[model samples]
Target: MSPTLTFALAGNPNSGKTTLFNSLTGARQHVGNYPGVTVEKREGRLRAAGRDLILVDLPGMYSLTAYCADERAARSFLVEEKPSCVIDVVDAGTLERGLYLTVQLLELGAPVVLALNMMDEVRRRGLSLDTGLLARLLGLPVVATVARLGQGTDDLVRQALEYAKARRGQWKPLELSYGPDVDRALGVMAARIEADRFLTDRFPARWLALKYLEADEDVIVLARGRGPTAAFLEETAARLARHIRETQATYPEAVISDYRYGFIAALLRRGVLQRTASPDRLAVSDTVDRVLTHAVAGPLIMLAVLFCMFQLTFLTSRYPMDWLEAGFGWLGEAAGAALPEGLLKSLVVSGVIAGVGGVLGFVPLICVMFFLLSCLEDLGYTARMAYMLDRVFRAFGLHGASVMPFIISGGIPGGCAVPGVMAARTLRSPKERLATILSAPFMACGAKIPVYLLLIAAFFPEHPGMVMFGITVASWAAALCVAKLWRATVIAGHSTPFLMELPPYRLPTLRGLLIHTGERAWQYIKKAGTIVLAISVVMWAAMTFPGLPPDRLADYDAERAALAAEREALPDDGSAQADRQALGERLDDLDNRQTEEALRRSLAGRLGVALESLSRLAGFDWRVNIALIGGLAAKEVVVSTLGTAYDLGQAEPEAPQALSGRLAADPRFTPAVALALIAFTILYAPCFVTVAVMARETNWKWAAFAVVANTALGFAVAVAVFQIARIW
Candidate 1:
C-alpha cells in the first residue's frame, strides 16, 4: 500500500491559493476553526498518481512571523504539524513580495513545491520569468500555473506528490547567511540549542536561534521554559543586538530581513527576471487608478458608486420583491382556506408564512446587493475605497484598516456584523480594535438590509433610491460619530497608519460570480427555513397564548351580535342594501378592534404595551415594539416579527394585503413613525450573534457596554426624530 501523504498549501492573500485548493480538492473539503483560535481551518483530500493526499489550506499570510493572528497560525501549523510537503502558491506578477513568504517557508525546512500562479497577469504586464532557473535557484520544483483558469494545476499537484513521497517525515531546515555579524551569533546559539535540544522536536535549533534574534515573543517564551540555557542564548542575542544597533543603526530583525531580500535580488539577477518596461507605467490597473484614486475625484466617484449601487438594488429588486409578496400572500390565503380557522391555521399563515416568508421575500434584494458588492470586492475597488478614506478615518481616530471591518459589517448595507466584528482583529491597537468592533455593528448589515428596505418601501415609496441612500449615509455618520465618542472616552488612542495592496481589477468569471451569489442567496433562504422558522414559531406562541379574557370576549361578541341583529332587521329592498353594507362595514371594524385587543392581551403584546410608555415617544406602537424586540435576536427578524404581528392584529378584510400595504393602511403607522422606526433600527444594538461575537473578540464588559450604549443612543435619536417630525 502506498503511504498517504499530507501537504500544506500556503500563500499571501490574493495569490490565487484558494482557487488552486478548490481546483485540487473540488467539493471534498471541510471548513472549521483552528482549536482555541478564530482563524479558519480548511482541509481537503485528493487522490493523484495512485496516492491519497491530504491538502491543508493554511491562512493567507505575508510571512511566518509571530506578530499577527494569521502569521502565528501559519507558523504554529508548520512547526507543529510538520507536513510532508508545502506547496507555496506565488503570485507571478508580485514575485518580490510573494517570495518573502517563500523564503520563510524554505527556512522552516519544509520540502517545498512552488506554484507560480497568475502567469497570465505576468504575461499581460509584458514580464517574463525563467521558471527553470528560478526553481534551480530556490532549490525546489517551480510549476508555472494560472490557478484561476486551472492551467498547469495538474502538473503542480504531480510535482507536490513526488516531493511528498521523497521527503516524508524528514526535513533539513534551509540556512541563509545574514552577514558575518549575525551568522557568528547564530552559530553560537545554535550550538547551545542543539546541546540542550531546546524545542528541537518542534523547531530546528538554528531556526530557533534565528527566531530569538528576530525577538519573536512566542519563541522567546518557549526558549525561556527551557531554563538556564535560555538565559545564555538571550544574553548572546542582546550583546549582538547592541553591537549591531551601535554600528549599523539597525536591529537583528532588520539584519535578517535585509539579507533575505538580498538573496532574492541576487537570485532574480541571474537571468531569471526579464521585463520589457517599468511594470507600473505600462499596467492598465495603474491607468485606471490614476483617475479612480484621484484626490478630488476619488471620494466623489465612491459616493456615485454607492448611489448607483443602491439605485440598482432598489430598481432591480422591486418587481421580484412584489412577486414574492404576492406569492406569500397567495400561500397565506391558501392556508387560510384549507385549514379550519383556529390556532393551527393561524400558526401556518401568520407564524410560518407571514413571519419566515416575509424574510424570504427580501432574498432577491439581498442577492442583488450581494452580487454587486462581490463584484466591487473582486474588482479590487473596495481596497481603493479604504485607501481614499484613510485620511478621513485617521481624523476620526480610526485606522484606515477599520474601513474593511466596517464595510464587511454592512458598511455597504448588505453585510453582516459577525464577520465585521471579526475583521477588527486586524487592528493592532486594542483601543482602535474595540472601537471598531463597537462601531462596526452600526453599519447596515445584510440582516438590517431587509428591515430598511421594507420600511423604505412602506413609507418613502416615492423615492426608495434616495431614501435607501440616506439610510446608508445615516449608518455611516452614526458609526463615525460613535467611534469618535468611544475614542474620546473609553478606548482612546492615537490612530495607526494603514497600508494595503490593491489587487489589479479583472473581469470576474461568470461561474465564480454565480457560485458566490448562489451561496449567499441560499444562506438567506436556509436561515428563513430554519433559525427564523423556529424563532417565528416561538414568537407566534408568545403572541397567541392566553386568549382574550372571557369578559372582554363576551363584550365583543355582544356588540357583534347587536350589529348582526340590526342588519337582519332591515327590509328586503334596494334601499336596505346600503344599510346592510354599512352594518357589514361596522362589523369588520368591530372584528379588527377585537383582534387588536386580543393581541395586546397576549404575552408578546403585553410586553410591548409595558414598554409603550417609553417606546411611544419614538412613535412606536406596541406592535412595532414587539418587532423591535425580536430584532435583538437578528435584524431581519424585525421584518418577520412585524409580519407576524400585523397578520394577527388585522382583520380578515386586510388578510390579502402585504405587510407594507397593511402598515400603510393602519392609522397608527404614519410616515413620521416609519422614519423614526428606521432611525432606531439603524442604530440599535447588534444582533445576538454579533454581540456574542463581540464578547468573544473583546470581553463581556465591552459587549454589555455596546448593547446598553447603542440601544440608549438609538432610542434617544429615535425619540428626537419622532418629536421633530411630529411638529413638521
Candidate 2:
C-alpha cells in the first residue's frame, strides 16, 4: 500500500522517448490536452517493484527555453508539477547533441536519470559509450537502453526509481562557468535572485539567472512584475549583454550556449566516448538519404510513395468498408421495420441511423490511412518529407516549419485542423505563422475524407486512388498558393530560415502502428457518435416538421386512392398487368412528389433552396446546399447530412440506400459536380473547432478573415471548375 510516484519522460524528438514510454506503459496510457493548452499530454500508470508509478510523456523539445507551445508545456510541467524524477532520454548515436538538453535539465536542478537510448545503433556504428565513466563525470546514474526493442528498460526504470528515492525531492542545481564576464554576471544575478527569493518557489535561483541571461520571455515577463529587483536584474543582464556584444561580437545567449557545449566537449574528451569507425563513413540513414533526399529524384519518390499510400488504403480498406456499410444499412432497415411509422421512427431511422452511419461507414478507410501515415512517421520519413519540401515551402513565402503544420492539418489526408492550427505556433515569425494558420485548413483532413471518398465512389469509381491523389495535390497547391498571396498582401514578412533534425530511419513495430492508428480511429468514431449524432438530430428536425398542409396531404391521399382503385380493377385480369404497373408507377411518382414538396417547404430545405440560385453555378442543388451548410460544423457532417437529406426525400422511409449509391443514381450528380464539390470542400472554411482555435491562437480578426477569404476562394474555384467542365 504505497503512494504512487510520478516520473516525467523528457527528450528531443525521435530520441526513442516515446518508444520507451510505450514499452513502459503499453495499454495503460491515456492522451489529453495539457490544462489550458492544446499541446497533447500523455500519461500512463504501472505497478513496478510493489509501487504504483505514473509516467508522464512530455512533448518532445530541444530545450526548456519555451520557444513553442511544446517547449512551454514541457517546461511548465517540470517546474509546476515537480515530478518525482525527470528521465532524460538521449540518443546514444548522437550523444553530443543529445546531451545539450541534458545539460540544461541538470542545471535546472531536477532529479535526473539518463537513459541512453538507441544503444543498438550506437554499437552497430562501432561506437563505444563508457557509461560508468560518463556517470561518474556527470555525478548521476546513466543506463543504456534500446527502447524500441525493450532492451534494458527494466534496469533504466529501476535506476530512475532509486535515484528519485535517494534525492527525496531535493534539487541541487549544476553550476557551469560561462567564460569570465558572463560568469561574473551570472554570479551577480543569482545572488540578487536568491536574496529576493524571486520565483525561487518554482525555479531555482541559478536557473532563473541563466534564463534571464538567455532572455527567456516567460521568465522575463514574470521578473518584470517583481518590483525594483527585476529592474536590477535586467540592468545587470543588459550590462553583460552589452559587454559580450562589444568584445565577442555576440550576445550573452550565444556565449552561454557555447560554454555549455564546451562543458559537454570537455567531458567527452575524457575518454567517455570512443569511436572505432572512420569518421568519413556514412551511416545507413545518410546512405539512404542520398537518394531519398536527392534534389532531382526525391520529389518524384515522394509523390510515388504518396500515390501508393492512397492506392493501398483504398484497396485494403474496401472490404471492411463494405462490411461496415452493409452492417449499418441492415440496422437501419431493421429499425424502420420494428418501429411504427411516426416521428419517432423517422428520427431513429433517418437522423440517428443514416447520419451517424454514413460517417461510421468510412471508419475502415480512415483507419487504414492513419495506419500507413503512422508507419511513415515512425520510420522517420515524415521529417524527410518536411525537409525536402522546405524549398518549395519557402518559395511560397512560408517557413519550412509550415510544412509540418500543413501535414498535421491533413496534408497527408487524415490530419485534423485544430492541431494543425496549434502546430503553427512552432513557426517563429508572426507573419509566417499567421499565414500558415490561415492556409492549413486547406489540407484534406480526416473529417473531409468521408466526403471525398463518398464522391469518389459515386462519380470516379474507376480511379478512386488517382482521383484522391489529385484532390490531395490540389489541396496542397491551394494552400501554398493562398499562403503566397497572404504573404504578399495581408501578413507580409520575410520567411525565417528553417532548421530541422532528421531522425535516423527505423522499422516501425506493428504494435506501434496499431496503437497510433487505434487512437486516431477512436477519436473519429467518438466524434461521429457524439457531435455527428446530435447535429443529425437537429438537421432531421429542421427537415421534418410542420407535416405538410392538411390540404396537401389530402390531395396526395386522394391521388394514391385513385391509383390503388385503378390498379385493383386492372390487376384482377392477367392481361391488364402492364396497365396495373403503369398505375402503380403513377402512384409512386405522386408519393415522391409529396415527400419532395414537404422537404422543400421545411426550414432547412427552404434555406437550401434560397441558396440554390448561387450554389447552382457550382453544380450544387438545394440538397447539396444543405449538406454544405452543415459542413461548417464538421466536414464529416457533409456525408451525414447528405444521407439524412436523401433519406428524408425518399418515397419509402422503410428502405434506405447507401449515400454513394443514392448520389450516383441522381441525374443531377455528374462527375463535374462531384469534382466541383470536392474542390469547394477542400478550400472552404475549416470546421467550427478549427476556427475557434485559430481565433484563440491569433485573434478574431484573422480567424474571421480565414472564414470569409477561404469560403470565397472555394466558391470561386468550384464555380470555375463546374463551368469549364460543363462546357467541355
Candidate 3:
C-alpha cells in the first residue's frame, strides 16, 4: 500500500464538517466508540492523488478547551495522534467565530488547511472574504466549499494533502500576544518547558504553557504527574494566574480567550472581509425565524408541520403496504402448496414468512417517514422544535437539551429509543438526564410505529392520519407526564438552562436526503432480518410444540372423517352438491378448531392463557398477550409475533388475511381492545436493546426500575382506556 495521509477534520458544531466528511468518505466509513467513553470515533479512508488518505472526523467543538467530552476528545486526538494535517472546517458566514478555533489549532503547531464551508451562505448574505489574503495572513492553505452541494470538496482535499505533504515535520508553533502580563509568563514557562522537554513530545511548549495558564484540568493533571520539573512549571503557572487575577481582576484563561477573538477581529479587518454597510442586516433565515420561532405562532406552526408530515406518510405508504400484504399472502399460499402438511410448512408459513413479512410490510411507511424526517432535519426545523419546546419541557422538569433526546428517541415518529436514550448524555443535570432517559421510551419510535399502524388500520382505518397524529401526541404527552412523575417523586433536581445555536436553514439536497433516508431505512431492515427474525423463530417454536395429545388428535380425525363421510353420502343431484359443500365447510371449520386447540396446548399458548387472567383487565386476550411478550424483545416483534400466532391458529393455513384484517375480523378483538393494545404498546417497557442501553447509560437499578415501572404504567393506562371505552 502507498503511504497513507492521515488528516483530522475539526470544526465547531453545525459548521458543515460532517457534510464534508460524508461527501469525502461515502460508504467507506465506520463509527466506533471512543475508548472508555460513549463518544463516537469516525474514521474513513479515501484514495486520492495516487495515495490513500485516512480521514478522522473529530468531535465538533468551539475551542480546544477541555471542558466537555467533545472538547477533551478532539483536543486529545489532535495533540497525541498528530494527524498529517488538520482541516478546520469554518463556516464562512460566521468567519470571525470560526477563526477563534483556527487560531488555537495554529498554536498547536499542526499543519492546517481552512475548509471555508457554507461559502454560498456567505455570498447570499452579501459578505465576501479574501481567501488569498486570509490564507497568507494565517500562513495556511484556504479552500472555499459548499459541502452540501459537493462544490470544491475535491479541491479542499487536494489542497489539504498538498499542505500536509509540504509541511511534513517542518512545522513550528505560532504564539499570539495575550497582553504584557500573560506573554511574560508564557515566555518564562516556555523556556522551562523547552529546557526539560517537558510534555513537549505531545504538545508544543508554548501551547503547554498556555494550557497551564488557562488552568485546563486534564493538562494540569498531566503536568502534576510529570515529575518535579513539570510540577515546578505548574507552580509557576499558578503564581502567574494569581498575579493576573489580582492585577487585571480576571483570570488568565479569560484574558487569553479575549486576545484570541481580538486576533481574529484584527485579521478580519485587514481587507480580508467586506460586508454590506449595515453590519447587522437580517437575512432570509431571520425573516423565516421571525414567524417560525414566534412565541405564539411557532408552536402552532410546528404542530401543523408535524401533523402534515405524519398525514403524508400515511397517505403515501398505504398502497405499498397493501401490495406487500398481497405479496406475503401469495407467498404463504405458494408455501402451503409446495410443501406437504407438516411441521416444515408450518415453520415456513407461520414462523418465517408471517413473522418477517409482517415487519417488512411496514417498510414503505418507515421509508416515507425517514425521508421526510431527514428533510426536516436537513432544513433545520429540528432545532426549532427544541427551541420551541424548551419551556414546555421545563414544566415537566426536563432541560431544553432533553428535547433533542426525546425527538431522537421518536418524538418525530420514526426515531429509535436506543439513540434517544443515548442522547441523554447532552443533559448536564443528572436528575434531568435520568428522567429523559426513562421517559424517552414512551415516544412513538419506529419500532412501535408498525404496531400502532397495524392496530390503527384494523380499528381506526377511516382516520389513520388522525389516529397516527393522536398516537404521536399521546406519546409526547405520555413521555412528558412520566418525566414529571419521575422528577416529582424519585429523581428531583432543578433544570438546567438550554442554550443551542440554531443553524441557518438551507434547501436540502436530494442526494443528501436520499443518503440519510437510505441509511435509516437500512438500519430498520437490518434489525428485522437479524433481531426480529431470530426472535420470531424462537417465539414460533415456543408456540408450536407440545403437540395436541393423541386422544385429542384422534377425536379431531374422527370428526373430520365423519364430516367427509356425510359429504360423500349426499345424493348426486344439485341439492346434494350444495349439501356436500356445506359438509365440507363444516369439515374446514373443524380443522381450524383443531389447529386452535393444538396451539392452545403448546408452550407459548399455555403461557399466554395463564397470563390472560391478568391481561384481560387491559382487554388483551391470550393471543395478544403472547405477542406483547414478544415485544419485550423488540417492539417490531409484536406485529410479527401476532402474525405468527394468528396464522398458525386461524382457519386458513394456506391463504390468510393480513394481520390487521385478521385482528379486525376476529370476534374476540374489539375496537376497545385495539385502542387498549395501542396504549399499552405505546407506554410499555422499552425493547430489550433500549433497556440494555439504559443500563449502560445509567445503572442496572434504574434499568430494572424502568421495566417494572413502565410496564405497570402502561398496563394501568391500557386498562383505563378499555374500561372507559366499554363504559361508554
Candidate 4:
C-alpha cells in the first residue's frame, strides 16, 4: 500500500491560505474541533500519485508560540501530527509580512514550500518578485499564482507531493543571532531540560527555555515532569528573564522580531533589481480610516452605519416578509376548506401548518440581515470595525481580534460561537481568551431577531423600525457592560496589548460572499422550518382547548358563519368591512384561545404564567411577562407565542393591523412594560445551543455562571429601564 502523505497549509491572515485550501480540496473539506479546544479543525483529502494526501489547514497566525489559542492549537498539530510537508501560503502583494510567518514555519524543521499567492495583485501594484531568488534564500520550493483563480494551486500540490516523497527523518534547527550572552544562556537551559521528543525539534529548545523563565503557561504545562531537569531549567530561565528585563529595553520576542526585519531589509536590498514605489489603495483606505478611527467620529460612524444597515434590513425585507406571511395565512385557509374540524384537521390547520409555516415566514428578513453582514465581511471592512473598537474592548480586558467570534456568533443558533471562542486563541493571554468566551453571547443573535420584531410590532406599534434598532443597540451595550463586569470579577485581568492587520479594501469576491450568505441563510431556514416548527406545533397543541370534538365544532361553525355575515353587512365605508372580516377571524381564533386558557391551567402555560408572575414583580404584566418566559428556549418564540396567543387572545381583529398590532394597543401594554421586555430580551442569555457551546468551549462551570449572571443582569437591567422610563 502507498503511504499516506500529510500536508499542512499555514499562513498569516488574509494571505489567501483559505482560498488555496478550497482550491486544493474543493468541497471535500470537513470542519471539526481540535480535541480539547474550540479552534476549528479543517481537514481534507486530495488524490496524488495514487495515494491519499491528507491536507490540514492550520489557523492563520503570525507565530507558533503557545501564548494564544490559534497559535497553540496550530502549534500542537505541527508538533504532534508532524505533517510530512508544510505548504506556506504567502501574499505576493505583501511578501514581507507574509514571509515573517514562513520563516517561523521553516524554523520548526518542517519541509516548507512557499505558495506566493495573489500574484495578480502584485502585478497590479507594479511589484516584480524574483521567485527563484526567494526560493534559494528560504531553501525551499516556491510557486507563484493567484489562488482565487485556482492558478498555481495544482503546481503547489504537485510540488508538495514530490517533496514528501524524498523526506528524511532529520532536519536542521533554526539558527538565530540573540548575541553571545543570550545564546550561552539558551544553551545552558536546553542542556538542563528534558521534555517530549516532539518539542525537541518543532520549537527552538532555547526559545522554550526563555518562555519557561517568564513562567509561560504553555511552557510550564508541557514541561510538567522530569522533576530535577525541569526545576533546574525553570529556575535558571526565571533568573535569566529578570536579568534581561533589568538590562534590556525590550522583551525577547520584540528583539527577535526586530532582528528578523533587519535581516529581511538587507536581503531585499540585495535581491531586488530596482526598488520602485507603486501607487497603492493603501493610501485611500488609510485616509478614510483616519476619520473613521477618530475617537469621536469613529463611534458616531459605527452607530450611523449600524442604524442604516438595520434600517435597510427592515425596509428592504418588508415586501418579501409580508408576502411570506400572507402565503402562510392562505395555506391555513386552504387546510380549513379541505379538512373537517378534528384532531388531524386542527393539527394541520393550526398545529403543523400554522406552526411550521409561521416560522418559515421569517426567512426573508433573516436572509437580508445576514446577506448585508456577509458583504461587509467579504470586503474585509468588518475587521477594521474591530480595530476601531479596540480601545473600548481593551478597557474590558479584550483585544480587537476577540470581537470577530462574538460578532459572528450573535447571528444564529449554533452560530460562529465555537469559532468565535476559538478566535480568542489569537490573544497572547489565556485570561483574555477566557474572558472573551464568557461575554460573547450578549449580542442580540439572529435567533432573537424574530422575537424583537414581534415584540416591537406588538409593544411599540408607533415605530417598528426604531424599536428594532433600539433593541439591537441595547444588546451591544449590554454586551459591553457584561464584558467589563466579567473582567472585573470573574476573568480578573487586563488584556495583553495586541495589533490587528487591516486588509486593503478590495471588491468582495462574489462567489465567496454568496456562498457564505447562503450558508448562514440555510442555517436560519433549517431552524425556522424544523426546530421552531416543532416548538410552534407543541405550543399550538397546548393552545387548543380541553376538547376539540362534536359539541365545539357546531358552535364554532355557527359563530364563524354569523361573524362572516356581520362583517359583510357593515356600512360600505371599506374599513367597516375590514372590521367585519376581523370579527369573523376572531371567531376562528376562539378555539386557540380555549386551548391556551387550559394550558395556562395545565403544565406549560402554568410555567409561562409563573414566569410572567415573577416578571410582574419587576413591573411587567402577564402578556409582556409571557413573552419573556416563552423567549427562553428561542427568542423568535416570542413572535410565534404572541401570534398563537393572539389566536387564543380575543380575536376581534380591527382594521388592518397584524395580531401583534392589537396586542401593542391594549391598555395593559404600556410603553414602560414594552421597553422593559425589550431590555430583558436584549441582555438575557442566549438559548441552549449557545450555552452548550460556551460550556464546551470554556467548560461547563463558566458556561453555567454565564447563564446565571445574565439571568440576574437581564432582570436588573430590565427593571432599571422600566422604572427610569416610567418616571420620565
Against the true structure, whose lDDT is highest? 2
Per-residue alpha-carbon lDDT of candidate 2 for residues 1-728, written as tens digits (9 for 90 to 100): 66789999999988989989999999999998888776789999987788899999999889888887889989999999999999999998889999999999999998999999999888777789999999999999999999988999999889988998999988888999988998888889889888888888998988988888899988899778778889998889889889889998999999899999999999999998988788777789989999999998999999999999999999999999989888988999899889998899889988899999999999999999999999998898989999999999999999899989999999999999998898887777878989999999999999999999999999888999999999999999999999999999988888898989888888888987998999999999999999999889989998887769899999899888888887776647689988878888888788889888999899999999999999999999999999999999999999999998999898785344578998999999998899899999999988999999999888899989999999999999999999998888
Q: Which predicted model would earn the best TM-score?
A: 1
* lDDT tens readout by residue for model 3, 1-728: 65788999999889999989999998899998766667678999898899898999998888887766667778888887888999999999888888989999999888999999999888888888899999999989999999888999999988988888899845578889999989998999899889998977788888998988888888888778768777787788889888987888888889999999999999989999998547888888888999999999999999999889988998999999899888988998999889898889888999999999999999999999999999999999999999999999999999888999999999999999998998887665779889999999999899999899999889899989988999999999999999999999999878877788788998998987998899999999999999999999999999989889999999998988888887777788886877778788898889789889888889999999999999999889989999999999999999999999988897575454788888898888999999899889988999999999999888899999999999999999999999998788
TM-score of 4: 0.86
The 10 consecutive residues of candidate 4 with the worst lDDT sum are: 648-657
Whole-model Cα lDDT per candidate?
0.88, 0.91, 0.89, 0.70
Q: After superposition, how far is residue 284 of candidate 2 from its true place, in Å?
A: 0.7
Write the residue-wise lDDT of candidate 4 on 233-337 in tens digits.
Answer: 767766666667778955655656776677666656767323345544454556778887788998798777767777788788889988877777777777767
Model 2 CA deviation exceeding 4 Å by range:
1-6, 25-54, 80-82, 188-206, 225-232, 276-280, 323-340, 568-575, 653-657, 699-704
Please give the RMSD to the true structure for each candidate, in Å.
Answer: 1.9, 2.9, 3.0, 5.1
Which regions in candidate 1 have their CA more than 4 angstroms from the true location? 276-281
Tell me the tens digit of each residue's lDDT in model 1 across 1-728.
Answer: 98778899999888899999999999999998777777778999999989899999998888776666666777888888898999999888889888998898888898989999999988888889999999988888999999888999999999988877777667878899999999999999999888888777788888889888988887888668568889998999999999999999999999899999999889889988898767556688888999999999999999999999989988998899888888888888888899997899889989999999889988888899889988888788998998898888888899888999999988887778898998877776778888899999989888888888788777889988889889889998999998999899988878776777777878787787788888878887887888889889989999988869899999999999999999999998888898899999999999989988888999999999999998999999999999989888988889999999988887673455778877888798998898899889878899899999999887899999999999999999999999999899
For candidate 1, what is the TM-score? 0.96
| Candidate 3 global Cα RMSD | 3.0
